[model samples]
Target: MKRKYSPYTLPPWLRKVRGACAQFIIPICVFQGIRTILFPFTLDVLLLTLLILLAVALHLNVI
Candidate 1:
C-alpha cells in the first residue's frame, strides 16, 4: 500500500513532460477560447480555434 505524487503516476521519465503540460495548458486554453470569441472572424482565427481544440485534446490526456 502506498501513496504516489501526482506526476509520478507515469513512468519515471515522463513525469517531467506531464508536469510541464499540466502547468501551461489550462491558461493557454482559456486565452484561445477568449481570443476566438472577441476578435473578427478570419482564416487565422479558424486555425487558432483548431489549435485550441488541440489543447483540449491535451487537456483531456489524449496526447
Candidate 2:
C-alpha cells in the first residue's frame, strides 16, 4: 500500500548540493577563526568571540 512518493524522496541535484555543503562549511569557518585568532595578538578579542560562535554553530549543526 505504498504511495508513489513521500518526503524522503528529493530530486538528485538538490540532495547533492546539500551533501557537498555539509562536507566542508564548518571546517572552513573554524579555519578562518583560527587564522585570525593565532596570527595577530591584536585580534584576540574578536578571535575568541568568532571561535566560540563557530563552535556553537558546529555543535548545533547549523553551519
In angstroms, the error of model 2 at 26 is 2.2
lDDT value for model 1: 0.69
Give the top-scoring candidate (TM-score).
1
Each prediction's number of clashing residue pairs? 0, 0
Task: Report the error of model 2 at residue 34, Å.
Answer: 0.8
lDDT of candidate 1 over 1-63, digit per residue (tens): 875445446797686776677678777767766777887578658767776776777666655
TM-score of 2: 0.42
**Which residue segments of model 2 deviate by more than 4 Å?**
1-9, 39-63
Mind giving the per-residue lDDT tens digits that candidate 2 earns over 40-62? 56566576677667666645555
Q: In model 2, what is the error at residue 59, expressed in angstroms?
A: 8.6
**Which window of ten consecutive residues has the lowest lDDT sum in model 2?**
2-11
